[model samples]
Each structure stands twice: as C-alpha cells, then as structure tokens.
Target chain A: MAIEIVQCGALITAALLMIIGLVALVYLDNVLKKIIGAAFIGDGVNLLIIALGYRVNGIPYIFLQNMDVNSFLGQASYPLPFALVLTSIVIGASTLAVMLALAVVLYKRNGTLSATALLNDKKLGEENNE
Target chain B: MDGTIFIPLMVVIPIICAVLVNLLHEHSGVTKIFGYIGAICLPIVPILAVYGNHFFGGYQPLANGGLTVALPEAANAIISGSFLELFHPAITYAFGPGQQVILFVLGLVAMCAVFISIAETKKTSGVYLYMLFMLSAALMAFVLTDDIFNLYVFFEIAALVQVGLILVSRVRGNYETGLKYMLLGEVGGSFMLLGIALILGLTGNVNISDIVMMIHTGLVNPTNPVLLFAAGMLIYGWLYATGLPPFNAIKSEIYSKGLPSGSMLLQSFSVIACISIGLVIIRIFGYLPTAQMAMLAVSVIAMILGICMAMVQDDYKRIIAYLAVGELGYIGVGLGLATPLSITAGLFQAVNELVVTSFLFIGFGLVLYKTRTSKISKLGGLVEYMPVAALLTVLAGFAMAGVPPFNVFQSKYLLCQAAIAAGIPELAVIMIILSIVTFLAFLKMAYAIFLRPKPDELEVSSASVPKTTMAVMIVFLIICLIIGLFPGLVVDKLGVLALTAFAL
Candidate 1:
C-alpha cells in the first residue's frame, strides 16, 4: 500500500506539471514563456513515463550471473519506458530549439515576444496582401 | 529476400535525399539533379516494392524465434503462457495495399510538388529541398509504421519539417505563422505524448499491434479509465494534427503562408495525418460509441465551418486552404462512421483529397506565381492570358466541389453511400448538401479569380506558364478523370483496409 501510494504521488506530480505547463502555454502572453511551458509539458510526459516504469523495492532490469530468471522478470523495473523517454527528450529538445529559433526570428521581425501582438487572428488576417 | 525491404527504403530514401540535398545546396546544378532523382524515386519505390511488415533491427516476437540472446527456460515459459508471446519486440512498419495506394498518391503529389519546385525556381535551395524531403519521410513513416511510438518520433519530425517548409517560403508573416504553429504544436504534441504514455502504462507496450491485440484478447481491459483518457488525448492530438476544429484556422493559415508548391505538399501532409492518426484512433477506440460520436461531431463541424469560413475569405489562398480543410471533414465523417464501408470510403476520400487538393493548390499557385498577390479581388480575366491554365484551374475547382467526372466526386459519392450504409441517412443528406455548397463556393472563387473582368489596377503579367507546371497539372487532371470514371480502381483497394480493420 505504501509503495502504491508513493507511485500515485509521483503520477500526481507529473499530472500537475502537465497541467501547469498547459496553463502557462494557453494563458501566458509571452512567446518565450509559452515555449518554456511547452518544454514543461514534455518534461511532465517524460516524468509520467518514467514514473510508470518505477518499481517499489525492485531489482534492476538486467539479469546477473546465475540469477533466478523468473524472480528477475517479476521484480525488475520496466526498461521500455526509459528507452522511450530518452528518445522523447531528444525530440523534445530539438523541437524546442526550433520553436525557440522561430521565436527569436519572430522577435526580430515583429520586435515583440508577445503572443497576442504577433500571432493573434487580427494580425494574421491583415497579412494577406504581402 | 522478404518483400519488406522496400518498406524501410520508403522511409530511408527520403532522409538520404534530404542529407544529400542539404550538402549540395551550394551547387544548384547538383542539387537539381539529386532533387529530380529523389522526387522520381518517391513514387517509383512504392511501385517496385512488395507489401509486408518490416520489423526494425529484425526484432520480431520471441515466439517467432527473433531473440538474439538465449533466455532462461523459466522466462520463456512465462512469456509462452500469456499474450506476451505474440507481442512484437521491435518497431514494426506495415505496408498494406491501402497504405501502398495512399503512399503512392502522396509520393505522386510530392513528386509533382518537387518537380514544380525545381522548375519554378530560378535556382533551387538545398535547404528548401531538404525540408521537403524530410516532411515526406516523416509523413511516410506516419503512414507505414504500426508502432505508435515510432509514429510519435516522426510526428515531431513532421511538425518541425512543416514549419521549415513554411519558413522556406518568402511569404510575408510566414515566420509569425511558423512560430504560432510550433506554439500550438507544443500543446497538441505534449498531450499526444501523454496519451501514448498512458496507453503504454496500461498495455506495457508501444507497438500498436501488440497493444491492440492485448486489449482485444482481454490482457488489458479496454474500458479502464486510463485507457479512455488515452483515447481522449489521442483524439485531441488528431484534431490538432489534422486541423479539424479549433486548429482548422491555424492549419489553413499554414497553407496560405507557404509557396504554392509548398502549400500543395503541406495540405498532403495534413490529409495523410488525418488518415494515419484517425485510423489509429479508430483501430483502438472504434468499439466505443462515444469515441465514434466524438469523431463524427468534430467532422461535421469542420465541414460546416470550413466551407462557411472559406466563403467569406477575400484571399484566394485562404479560400482554397479553408476549402481544403472543409473537404477534410468528409474523410473524418467516413472514418468516424466506423463501419467497414465507411472506413473504406474515408480512405478513398483521403486518396482523392491528396490528388484533388494538390491539383487546386498547384492550379491556384500558378496565379500566385505569375502575380505577386493571392487576393481574389486584385485579379481578373486570367483566361484571356493563359487559356490552358485557366481552363485547368476551373476544372480543378470542379474537382474540389465534387463535380461529375472528377476524383472528388467519386469519393464524395462513396462517403455519402458509406454514411447511409452506417444507418445514418441524415449524415448522407448533410454530405450531399455540403458537396453542393462546396461546388457553389468554389464556383464563386473561380468566377472571381478567372472569369471576372480585369481590374484597372491589376497588373497582369504576360509571362508564359512553365511547361513543366502545365504537364503536371494535365497529368493531375487525367488522374482525377480516371478515378472519377473508375472509382473501383481506388475503392476496391481501399476496401481491404476497412475489412482488415474489422478483422482487427
């Protein structure tokens, strides 16, 4: 029961991270801050995935010499989600880099990091002539 | 040799092309040759390759003797006694006849887009070509891969490549549009990952086939709250990916900001995204009526909003972009219906959309290329200047509006049929009425852009349309005609997917 509680706590933290990040993303007016929020969302998902693989008082996923294979299989923390999180991190970082780079360029062009100033529908609608 | 070799090559060739082109960007001559070769290969590889599943790194199921390490007898026994034995241990890409057809059409549109890209430009930028190839590779991966995780990897790649494609265009406000899309993508994409994670947590697998099998065989309870949440998240991601509702405006904005060629390819990616992600959703959640209802509801709204919003647009590009998205609702309706016939019809609509929408984008693109602007009110009497292009553009519009003897007509007819077969006759009426509205709306734009008297301030350029562009447009028209006259050519192949989906 204690182990499950700890696991649930971690899951809750992950969910909170995601919620906060999403709130920052939608409600925050700053473009750079929104990017940060986006990063947080990725971080939250990574945490959730890692949390899913967490085992209470579990053995390593690898097998050792002369180990009991059945016990090893039953007790080992999952390795799959870890591998997934690794890839997701790389993808998330690259995507962040692109978004950040785009933000920098938008700032240079429009001279503002305010999302409303740049990305609002009114601004977009007025841009058809060019 | 297993016929699966072509499957991986389908993805690899594009990446390879991207790298080569990026390297040779400084040399336009070399880049041009590489670009042509790469574009031609996109369609040809699909044609030459046989269909089958390719297990990456040769990691098939342990039950199939795919293990490299000798496992203990006890571990093997445990795996053998449960659903684990049948689960794929590696990333899998399944290339069925349906995928083949769709991929082929995608490759064709991509090929034409590239052909036009190379020919239309004074000198091709390797960076632009690089973005194009990467976008194709990502979209192809999305279609070919059976692993949802693999799909995620390429999903990010697709999103980034799409932004790069928009940025490659010198269109005003492109950077703003690209950044905005990325910002929105962050929300949509992160949630999508969370959804995939939830499914992974529940099923202990990332391979879609394994997850599906586990759920179907009662290894993982499908109705679990976590699983339902995952479905909801996945559906949210689908809406974002395909630009169905709240995202529709952004998606059409994306189309309007790209070069005509780039927009042509961009719309294909969205259509492919709609098909790929929507199929995954259906496969996992189709049994749930709520899931199907959600899909149907969004699709109907997208159809209505897409056309109505388009009718009010003054910019020709925006109009076509909205129309493209509006037409997307048909595919959504077809897939949302979740019946075998509806699924096939949906798939068919997707294929037709790839062709027809690309045709319209390219046709309208000619006007944009000749004139510096895409505003409908700024131009008129184009038929007097380029007779062939004007007539072809009008025909493309007809195809979009579902006029007879065009590919969209055939697909729309199938969609209506599928909707009725699913016991929702009202859905059929909606589709028919929308089809007519689509026609009228397109005719309005056609008249404004092609037939209206020339404005005094309209600077009509006398430059001849590129012969290559003409050839591509003619070929596209022929394809639409062929499909319209013989819908069986597509529906028969697409039906395989619907049947196979039911088998799942």
Candidate 2:
C-alpha cells in the first residue's frame, strides 16, 4: 500500500512540474526564462520517464553469471525507460545550448532579449524599407 | 551491395561529406568538389539498393527467437518471474518502394539546392555546406528510421540544423525566428518524449512494428485513456514539426528568412516529417475515430488559414511559405481519410509538394538573387529582363495551385476523390475552394512582380541571372511535367506503402 502511494506521488509530482514548465514557456516573455522553462520541461519529462520504470525496492537491471534469468527479470526494474531518458536528457541539453547560442546572437544584433521589442524593430525596419 | 551496407550509407555519406566540407572550409574548390560528389551520390545509392529489412545492432524480432524463462527458488519469494523476460529490441528500418520514392525526391532536391548555393554565393563557406548536408541527412534518416526513439533523435537533429541554416543565411530577423522555433520545438519534443514513455510503459517496446503487433494482439489496449493521451501528445509534436495551424506563424517566418536553397531543404523536412509522423499516428491510433477527426479538422484549418494568410503577405517568400503550409493540409487530409487510396494520395502529394515547392523556391530565389529583395511590393516588371525565370515561376505556381497537367493537381484530384468516396464531400469542397484561393493569391503576386511595369527604384539592368540557375529551374520544371503526366510511375509504389500502413 505504501509503495503504491509513493509511486502515485512521484507520478503526480512529475505531471505538476511539467504543467508549471509549460505555463512558464507559454506565458514568459524573457528569452532566457523561456529557455529555463524549456529545461524545466525536459527535466519534468525525464522524471516522468524515470517514475514509469520505478518498482518497489527494485534492483538495478544488471546480470550476473550465477543469477537465474527468472530471478533477474522478477527483481530488476525496467531499464529501457532509463536508457531512453538518458538519451532524451542529452538531446535536451544540446537543444538548450543551441537555443542559448541563438539568444546571444539575437542580443548582439537587436540589443534586446524581449520578443516584443524585436518584433517592433522588425516592423519599423519593414516600414523603412517600404 | 548488402541491404545493411547501402541503407546506412544513404544517411552516412552526406554526414561524412558535411564533416569533410567543414574541415576544408578554407578550400572553396575542394569543398565544391566534395559537395558535388556528396549531392550526386545521395540519391543514386538509394536507387541502386534492393529493399528489405535492415536491423540495426543485429537483433531480430521476437518471433524469430523463442522465449525462455528460468527462475530461482530463493528470489521467487520476493517477486514473480512472469515479467522478467522481454525481447531485446533492435532498431528496425524497413526499406521499401515508399522510402525509396521519398528519399529519391529528397536527394534530388538536396543536390540541386547545394549546386545552386555553390554557384550563387560569392564565397561558399564550409559551415553553410555542412548545415545543408546535415539537414538532408537528418531528413533521410527521418524518412527511413523505424524505431520511435531513433525518429525522435533525428527529429531534433533536423530542428537544430534548421536553426543553423537560418543563422548562416545572415538574414534580418532570422535569429529571433530561430529562437522562437527552437523554444516551441523543445516543448513539442518534450511532450513527444512523454508520450513515447507512456507507450513504452504500456507496450514495453520501442520498435514500431513490435508495438503494432502488441496492440494487434490485445497486449496493449487501444481504447485506454492513457493511450489516447499519448496519441494527443504525439499529434501535438506532429503539428509543430509539420507547421500545421497555430505553429504556422513561426514556420512561415523561418521559411521566409532562410536562403532560398535552405528554404528548399526546410520545406522538404516538413513534407517528409508529415508523411513519416502522420503515418505513425495513423498506424498506432487509427482505431480511434477522434484521432482521425482531430487530424482532419486541423488540416482543414491549416488549408483555410494558410491560404488566407498567404493572400495578405507582401513578401514573396512569406507567400510561398504559407502556401507551402497550406499544401501540407492536402497531404494531411489524404492521411486523415484513412482509406488505402487516400493514404496513397497523401503520400503522392508529399512527393509532389517536395519537388514543386523546391522548384518554386528556386524560381523565386532567382528574383532574390538578382534584385536582392523578397518583398513583392518593391519590385515590378521582371519578365522583360528575366523571361525564362518568369515563365518557370508561372509553371511552378500553377503546379502549386493544382492547375491541371501539373504534379500537385493529380494528387489533389485523388485526394478529392478519396474524400468524397470516404463520405466526406465537404472536405473535397473546402479543398477545391482553398486551391482556387491559392491560385488567386499566386496570380496576384505574379501580376505584381512579373507583369507590371518596372518601377524606377528597381534596377533591371544591374540584375545578372546565372545560366546555372536557369538550367536548374528548367530541370525542375521538366521533372514536374513528367510526374504530372505519369503519376502512376510513383503512385504504384506509394500504393503499397498505403496498403501496408492500413494493414497495420
């Protein structure tokens, strides 16, 4: 009973974190904060994946020469999701790095990080060209 | 060559060339040679290879290897042994006529785009060539991979390369657009990952074929709310990736800001991603009526909204971008119809859209190259100076608007027929109206830029049009005419893919 409650708690927490991150991503204006929001979303997803693989007092998914296949399969937690999350985290980090690089470039060119200011500048430039 | 050898080579050669080009960044001559070689070889290799199952890491399906379980008495008290054994999953890539057709179009476009980029630019940077190769390679992988996780990885790579393509173009407003696209892509990708996790939890496999089998065997419940949520999440990623409605705003901006060659590759990504991911969704969740309905509704919205938005754009690039997004809706409708013929038409539209859009981008690119502007309002009477370009542009434009005797028209006709046969005549009506609207929109731009008297501010004498550019445009126009005349040459292969998708 206790183990089931703990599993549910972890799942709920992961969902809440994801919701918060999404809110920040959609509502926030600052480029840097939006990037942070992206990271939060990645972390939230990572946590969710990890929670999916969790088992009560589960053993690590490893094999020993002497261990029987049945015992290993019964006791070990699922390892596929863990592997997937690890790759997901790496991809997320690379994406975050690229986003930050673009942000730096935007700041250098426009002298601002706010999306609204950038849009205004574009509008003004278009009008000038016309 | 063996299936394993050539299948991976189709993806790897471009990547290797990208690295080689980047290393030879200072040697323009050498990079040009390497670029040409890579571009020419990408399509040829795929065409030469025989289609079959190519398993990454050499693991076969569970049916090939029988299962066995062994349990020790000591550990039995703590846990049950029934769940311990699982099939070792391998990344399975099924190469068939469908992948071959898509890869062929991608390769041809990439080749032409790279050749055009090399000829047009004064100083060809290796990094630029690198991004082009990376983008094409990622797209090739996107269409070829059968593993869900592998698809996600390639999808991210394609996204980054898209940003790189924009950043390297040195266009104004590209940086902000790239950032916005990246942020949204990140959110969409995370949701897709969450969805994949749910599917994995339920099915215990990432191989798409295995998951399909599991679902078919009733191991995974199709009607589960959790599965429905997964479907929704995957659909969100699909919309963002393919530039469907709501995501179309930033997507059009990305296209407009890119170098025309880059835009060619970018639109290819959108088409291939739509086919690949859209098929995946239909494969996994076609059992649900809501899923199909959702796709149909979104597609109609994209068609209506894209044409309307396109009609109002002053920039030629933005106009093409929105129209391109609108064309994606036709493909979506075909997929959403879920009939074998409709799906075949959808895949056929994907191929046509790839070639036709690239042709249009290159045609308009000639204008940008000569005039140094994409704004339709600032230019006039280009036909007098560049008659060949104006002619080809009109042809490509007609193709896009689904005029008869063009590539898009046949596929759009099939789509209409499929929709009506599927008992949804309204979809056909809406599609016809949108195509007409698109035709008018393109006609207006055509008149404004190509036929009107030359404005004083626009200098026609200084415009230097390259022979190579004209040659590439003619080649694309010829290809379009061939396919438009004989779509059966490609549609037969696509029919097999459609049947396979429906069977699953």
Candidate 3:
C-alpha cells in the first residue's frame, strides 16, 4: 500500500499542536490562553484521525445507485478513523467542559483568572499568619 | 459468553438514576426513593453479572471480540494462560479469586455506606449519580479492560467525575481544593497519554496482548528509550493519582475541603484510582526489575511519610486523611512485592481499607454534625452520651489499626508474610512498626474524644442520633464484620481472578 503524503503532513501538524499546547500550559500565566492551547491540541487530534482515512484521489465513502459492486468496493475511504474521530470528539468535549467548569469555579472563588493573583493571595495569607 | 449488556448496564443504570433524581430534586421524598433504588441496584448488577456470565456463558463478542480478557496478556507478559486474544478491542471480561472479588465486596460496602448516607442528608440528589459512575467506571476499568488505552480513558473519566462530586458538596474552600485536584489530574492525564503514545509508537498496537507478543519477540525492546520513558510516565501518573509522598499535600488539601460525606466519596475514588493505576503499571512493566524497585521506593515513602504527618495533626479529618494516605501505601507495597502472596495480600488489604476507611470517615461525619467541628482537641467524652456513635467509631479506628477479627487485620498479616517471603524482612518490620504507631495515634484520638472526661456545655441529645445516619454506620459495620470473618470468601476468589487477569 502506498503512503499518502497528506496523511504524513497531518500527523506532523498534530504533533506540533500537542507540543505547542504543552508549552502554553507550562509557560503562560493567563488561564484563557491555556484553555485555547488545549482546544488547539484537541482539534489537531481530530484532524489527524481524519487524515488517517485519506487516500489519494479516493472517492467519497458513498454508494451510487446502479453502480457495479466491484467499482463501489474500491472507492470508499477508511471507516475506522471516522469512528475514532467521533470518539475523540466526545472525549475532547467532556475535557473542555471540565476545564471550563474548574476555571469558572476558580473565578468565583478568587475573583481573578491570572496566576499572579493566586500567587499574591498565597503570599499575603502566609505573611499574615506569620 | 461473559455477559456484555450487564457489564455496560453497570455504568448505565446509575447514570439514568442520576438524571431522574436530579430532575426530581425539588421532591425530596422522590429523590430518597431514587437514592435507595440506586444503592441496592448498583452492587447487585455486577455481582449478578459475574454469576450469570459464569453459569450461562451467553458470550456475545465484545468490541466484536477484538479485546480478549486473559490474565497473562493482561498482567505478566511471559506467563502463558488460556484465553482468546481479541482481534479488535472487546471486553474479554473474566473472573477468578483475588482482587476482583475484593473490589466487588469493597464496592458493596461502599454502596451500603452511600445508601445510609442518603438518609443522613436532605436535598442532596445527583450525588449518588457521580458515586455510581465512579464505582462502575473503576470496576469496568479494573475487570473488563484488555487495552492499556481503555484503562487510561476510564481513569480520566473517573477522575473527572470524582472531582466534580467533591465540589458538589459546595463547602467553603472546596473550589480551591478542586482546582488543585484538576491541575494534578491534568498532569497525570498528560503523562498517561504520553505513556500510551510511546507504547503504541514502539509496538504499533494498543491491545495489551499484541504489545506483549511484540515484546516477547524483541520487537518492542526493553532498552528502547521510548519504552523506558513510557514506564517512567506511568509510575509518575500512579503517584499523582494515588497521592503517594510529596503528593500527600494535595490529597490532604482536597479531603479537608469536602464535608465528611463528600470525603467518603473522595476516599473511595482514591483507593480505586491508586489500585487500578498500580495494577496497570504492574501489568505492563512487571518484567522489568527497575520498575519493581521504583514501586518499592514509592510504597515505603507513602507509608512512612503518611504516618509521620498523621501523628502531629490536631484536625481529626486531616489525621484520617493522612492515615488514608498511609493505608494506600500498604496496598502499593503488596503490588511492589509482586509475589503471588504479596499481590493477593495487597489486593485484600485494598478491600479491608475500603470498608474500614468508609466506616471511619462516615463515623466522623456524625461527630462533625454534632460538634460542628472536626478538631480533636476541641471535643471530649463522646462515649458517655453518643454511645452508639462512639462504639462504631472505635470499631472503625481499631479495624484501621489492624486489630484481629476486623477486616484489615487479615490483609495486614498477609502483607507482612508476603514481604517476608520476598526476602524483604525490613518492609515487614516497617509495616509492623507503622501499625503500632497507627494504633497509638488512634488510641490518643479515642481517649481525647470518647474515653476522656467530659467537658461541661457539651450537650448530647437523643436528637443527635439521626436514624438514617445510624442506619449507615450499622450497615457499614456489619459489612466489615462479615468480610473480616470470611477472608477466603473474597480473597481466594478475587486473587485467582486477578492472578489470571495478570497472566493473560
């Protein structure tokens, strides 16, 4: 079986997105940016799954009425990646919901979304106790 | 035919109940009924499934029979066992004697406590939904899974639901604690994902059996950096999830943030997550001597550090929280030892800890309700007034200390014996010494709160005994006694199954 160049490109793109997401979470102080980074990584995964099904000049995975069975069998895109993307999408949505829920809870408690404010509060509380 | 629909229903039933109860939240009476039905149904489903699957063998293909649940492929790579290796990932669910039975029994006891708790609190619906979700997910992951990736997915789902349940208590400071939990959980999730990616990259198969077959052929070389990195990532993930040393601070903070009722839920999740994660690592990397060493070091750190921290705590819940940390260490030690005896002992210890700790945490909940405080030094002489509560509380504390005729003692004995058999006499001695310290500390607590002289102004009313709360405590206590008496009933069966799971 011949490897598709487009599929290779998509995998590399997904890998880069994941690396970027990791860096953003680690290096950025802003919480919203961190969330966006996570979203990008999730999108990248969805893209990779789609790409895995790609075949050069392959016809869409649809049946035409009156088409011969032999011709119909040879043209369909892979079905497994389509199913995987659906599963990944559900997992990704749930993760987003949780991350958002936590972020909202944090905002309600502390009144600021910045990491700096959290650090400041901790330092202040410690000094007062001392 | 290990029944498929029943296993999936294990998760589905509670979820449906959660939705129904949440809709009827305004009608407390309706919610209570829903709660009772849920509690009773949750454990029966899995227990009945085991019986039906064993007897009927109406085995439909799981994931179209792609995933085969066999022991050698699931646990030890080299050990051969009879089981089908599924072509695609399907539920290759099987049962034996050892950890699976222990977990089922633990799940039963936890459900009993949860039911009693329904009567303990009012206007609290949908909490049981999360509880059932956590239980079913943990058990499904523990028993049915044949792929490492599926196990990781269940771990993530359980962690997410568990953190949500912890915050649902809506107690003060809970948000912050939940945040910490989410952060740690995210890191753990990332590490586990990376580990899965590495394993797949090396072997091109996510199904555990194929990975093992590849490893056996030297196609997946042990010295591969990706494999080593995957191993490290897996261990670190286990540490965070289990709340081992250095991670204890977060566990303490999270447990303290929730009300005791909520803490009861958190504690059980902690036990399940730790054991499941440990089991996964042991399954994947059991052949590696270095991985065994790392597990041993973690077990030691958890036991020693947890007890040391527990000793100085004035807050009663914090003390128990620390002790829970240490108790998990005993489980880890059993897995680390990896001998048949030790692994069985560790799994048995896990069951003991589940029952005893639920009782202890719930028993403490009654105190929190009465005194409106969890501070040990602030209250005394509870035995004079709340005699029943005091009795249950004492029983739970003693059980935790590995007292005879209590659930934990049997497992504790086996852990020591197993450690000795493994030529680690020092671990056995350390465990013995830790048990002594644990007993002394609990004794101090018992004396200060229940046995010591009563202070004036502390009122004990018959009203203090919530009928529902009493029901919960009694139910939990009965489970502890029942399991303590028939150790082999659960251990022999669960151990055999767990050993078989590993062998496949």
Candidate 4:
C-alpha cells in the first residue's frame, strides 16, 4: 500500500510540474523565460516516463549467464521507457540549443526579448509600408 | 523488389542525399545535380515497390519461433489461454495503397519545390538543399512508419527542419517567428510523449499495430481514466502539429515569412502530418464517440475560423496561408467522419491539397519574384506584365475554391456526399458556404493585385519570370486537370486504404 502511494505521488508531482511549465510557456512574454519553460516541460515529461517504468524492489534490467528468462523478467524493471527517456533527453537538449540560438538572433536584431515588443515592431513596419 | 529492401530505401535515399549535399556545400553545380536526382527518385521508388508489411532488425517473431505468453487475469477473462505473437517488437513499416498514393503526391510536390528553389534563389546554398532533403525524408517516414515512438522522433526532426528552413531564408522577422514556433512545438511534443508513455505503461508496447491489437482484444481498457488522459494529450499534439485553431495564427505567420518554395514544402508537411497522426488517433480511439465528436468540432471550427481569417488579411502570402490552413479542416472532417467513404475522400483531399496549395504558392512566388513585394494594396496590374503567370494563378485559385474541372472540386464534391451520407447535412452546407467565401476572398485578392490599375507607387519591372518556374506551374496545372477529370485513378487506390482501415 505504501509503495503504491509513493508511485502515485510521483506521477502526480510530475503532472503538476508539467502544468506549471506550460503556464509559464503560454503566459510569460520573455523569449528566454519561454525557453526555460520548454526545458521544464521536457524534464517533467522525462520524470513521468521514468516513474511509469519504476518497479518496487526491482533490479536493473541486466542479463546474467546463469539466470533464467522468466525469473529475470519478473524481477527486473522495464527498460523500454528508460531507453525512450534517453532519446527524449537528447532531442530536448538539441531543441533548447536551437531555441536559445534563435533568441540570441532575435535579441540582436530587435534589441528586445519581449515577444510583445517584437510584435509591436512588426505592426509598426506594416503601418510604415501602408 | 523485396518489400523490406524498398521500404527502408524510401527513407534512406534522401538522408544519404542530405549528407552528400552538405559535403559538397561549396560546389553549387554538383549539389544542384544531386538535388534533382534525389527529388525525382524519392517518388518513383515508392510507386514501383510492392505493398506489404516490412520488418526491420531481422526480428520476425513467427520465423524465430512464436512465443506463448500468459495474459494478466483481466485479459485472460477476455481471451483464451495464452497470446500467440506473430511479429517481434522491431521497427515495422506498412506499405499499402493509401501510403503509396500520398507518398507519390508528397514526392511530386517536393520535386517541384526543390526545382523552383534552385531556379528562383540568387545563389543556391547546399545547407538549404540539405534541409529540404531532410524534411522530405522525415515526412515520408512519418507516413510510412508503424511504430509510435518512431513517429514521435520523425515529428521532432520535421519540426527542427522547419525551423532550419525558416532561419536559412534570412527573412526580416523569420528568427522571431521560428523561435516562437519551436517553443510551442517543444511543449506540444512533450504532451505527445507523455501520451505515448501512458500507452506504453498500459500496454507495454510502442508498436502501433501491437497496441491496437491489444486494445481491440480488451487487454487495455479504453475507458480507463489514464487512457482517456493519454488520448486527450495525443489530440492536443495532433492539433498543434496540424496547425488547427490556436496554432493556426503562428503557422500562417511562419508560411507568410518563409520563401515561396519553403512554404510549398511547409504546406505539404502540414497535410501529410495531419492525415498520418489523425489516422493513428482514429485507429486507436474510434470507439469513443466523444473523441470523434471532438475532432469534428475542431475541424468545423477550423474551417469557419480559417476562411474568416483569410477574408480579412491584406498580405497575399498571409491570405494564402490562412486558406491553406482552412483547407486542412476539410481533410479533418473526412477523418472525423470515420466511415469508409469519408476516410477515402479525406485522403483524396489530402492529395489534391498538396498539389493545389503548392501551385498557388509557386504562382504567387512569381509575383514576389518579379515585383519584390507581397502586399496587395501596393501592387496592381500584374497581368499586363506577366499574362502567363496571371493565368496560372487564377487557375490555381479556382482549383482552391473547388471550381469545376479542377482537382479540389472532385474531393470537395466527394466530401460533401460523404458528410451528407453520414447524416450531417449541415456540415455539407457549411462546407459549400465556406468554399464560396474562399472563392470570393481569392477574387478580392485577384482584383486588387492583377486587375486594378497599377499603383503610381508600384513599379512594373520588365524582368520576366524564369522559364523553369513557369514550366513547374504548368506541370502542376496539368496534374490538377488530369486528376480533376478522372478522380477514379486515385480514389480507387484510396478505397483500398479505407477497406484496410475498416478491417483493422
């Protein structure tokens, strides 16, 4: 009973973290803050995936020469989600790097990181054209 | 050719071309030749290949030895003793008639887009060509792969490639637009991952076929709260990826800011991804009326919002972008219906959209090419300078509005029939009304840009469009007419897809 509570608690915490990150992403106007928000979302998702694969009193998913297949499968934690998390982490890092690079470029060109400021400048350019 | 050999080749060829293009980045002459070959071959190989299931990693479960596994108590109650496995949990690609038809359209448009990029740009950059190839490969894999995780990976790669396509164009506000798109895309993608994780936790599988089988056999309860949450998350990802309502504003901005050739590929990505992911969702959750209704409502709202938004835009590119996004709703309506005929019509609409939208982008691209402007009010009397381009643009416009003897007309007609047959006459009526509004919107654009007197501030340059760009538009025009006249050629094959989907 206690173990089930811990697992459920971890899952709930992960979901809460994701919601908070999403709030920052949508509500925050600063581009840098948005990027951090994206990273937080990634971390929250990774945690959720890891939590899903967790097994109480389970060993790492490794094979030994003498071990039987059934016993090993029953005693070991699931490895697929862990492998998936590794790939997702790499993808997240690369996306973050690209986002930050674009932010740097935006800052250089418009001299502001605020999305609203950028929109204002665009609107101003349109008005000038008209 | 063997199914396994050719299935992987469809994805591999373009990837290899991207690498080669990057290596020869400084040699424009060599890279251009490579791009043409790569583009032409991507479509042909898929058409010639036989259709069947192809397994990778040499992991055929039946051939290795079918393993009998005991089911959990709940699953045991629904089925007999043990489950017999036929395929291993390896990367599987399913090639059917539907995949072939869609891939062919994607390939053709990609080829034309690549050719136009080479012809229109001042200097062809190898990295740009590389991004184009990578984007094409990612889209093809998105359509062809049977593994859910593989789809997610391709989705991420396609998003990054979209950003690359935007950044390399060097437009004024492109960096900002690309940043916003990437940030939102990351959040959406994480939601999709969470959804996939939920499914994996429930089914212990990532292969889509296996999950569907398990769900169908009642191993995974469709009514479970966790599964419902997963479905909701996946639907969120679908809406984001396809640029439905809230995402439509930013997506249209991305399209307007991108180069015309880039927009051509961007629209293709949107069409193909919507069909691919939408089909996956329906395959898994079609039993739930709420899920189907949610799709229907979103698509209907997309149609209303997209056309309404297009009606108010002054920029020519932004207008077309909104229209392109609006057309996506028609495809959505087809998928949302979930009937055999409706799914087929939806798939056909997807094919017609890829060609028609690209034709419009290229036709309008010629305007931007000659006049160096996208604002409609500042431009006028283009037909006097470029009559051929003007004619092609009108034809593409008419096709977009579902005028007779154009490709979209057939699909739109079929969609109406399917909707009414499915007991949704209001949807058919709404579709007709919105299409007329779309036609009027195009007319407004046409009169302002082509028929009105040339503005004093606007300089009508005498520089003619390149022969190659015009040739590409003419080819697309011919394709539209051919498909419009005889929709059976594609629809028959699409029927096979619908039947297969029904069987599943």
For TM-score, the strongest prediction is 1
Worst 10 residues of 1 chain A by lDDT: A121-130
- Which stretches of candidate 3 lie above 4 Å from their native place? A1-29, A33-86, A116-130, B1-5, B51-86, B89-91, B127-141, B217-219, B453-462
The residue-by-residue lDDT of candidate 3 on B248-301, one tens digit each, is: 867866666565656765777677767777777777787887887888888899
Question: Tens-digit lDDT track for model 2 on B156-259?
Answer: 89999999998888777667777878988998888888888889889988878767767866878888888889999999989989999889877888888889
Choose 3 or 4, whichever is better by TM-score: 4
Clashes of each: 0, 2, 27, 0
TM-scores for candidates 1 onward, in order: 0.97, 0.94, 0.84, 0.95
The deviation in Å at residue B358 for candidate 4 is 0.4
Better of 1 and 3 by lDDT: 1
Best candidate according to lDDT: 1
Task: Name model 4 segments beyond 4 Å from true.
Answer: A1-9, A119-130, B1-3, B63-81
Give the worst 10-residue stretch by lDDT in candidate 3 chain B: B78-87
lDDT of 4 at B57: 65
Model 1 DockQ class? medium
List of chain B TM-scores, one per candidate = 0.98, 0.95, 0.88, 0.96
What clash pairs does model 2 have? A70-B70, A73-B84
Q: Comparing to the true complex, what docking class would candidate 3 get? A: incorrect
Report each candidate's C-alpha RMSD, comma-separated, in the order given.
1.5, 3.2, 5.9, 3.2
**Residue-by-residue lDDT tens digits, candidate 4, B1-504:** 455578778889999989998899899999998988998988897888788767786555543442355434443343333453443558888888888988888888888888888887767778988988999999999889888989999999999999999888766677777887898899889999989999999998888877787887798897989989989989888998899877888788778777888899898888988888888888888787788788888999999999998887778888999999999999999999999999999999999999999999998988988888888878999999999899899889999999999999999999999999999999999999999999998888998999999999887668779888899899999999999999999999988876665554
DockQ of 4: 0.48
In candidate 3, what are the lDDT values of residues A1-130, reduced to their tens digit?
Answer: 3466667887899778877877776677776667666666666656755675676767776768876555555666756456556765676678778777878867886788875665243542232122
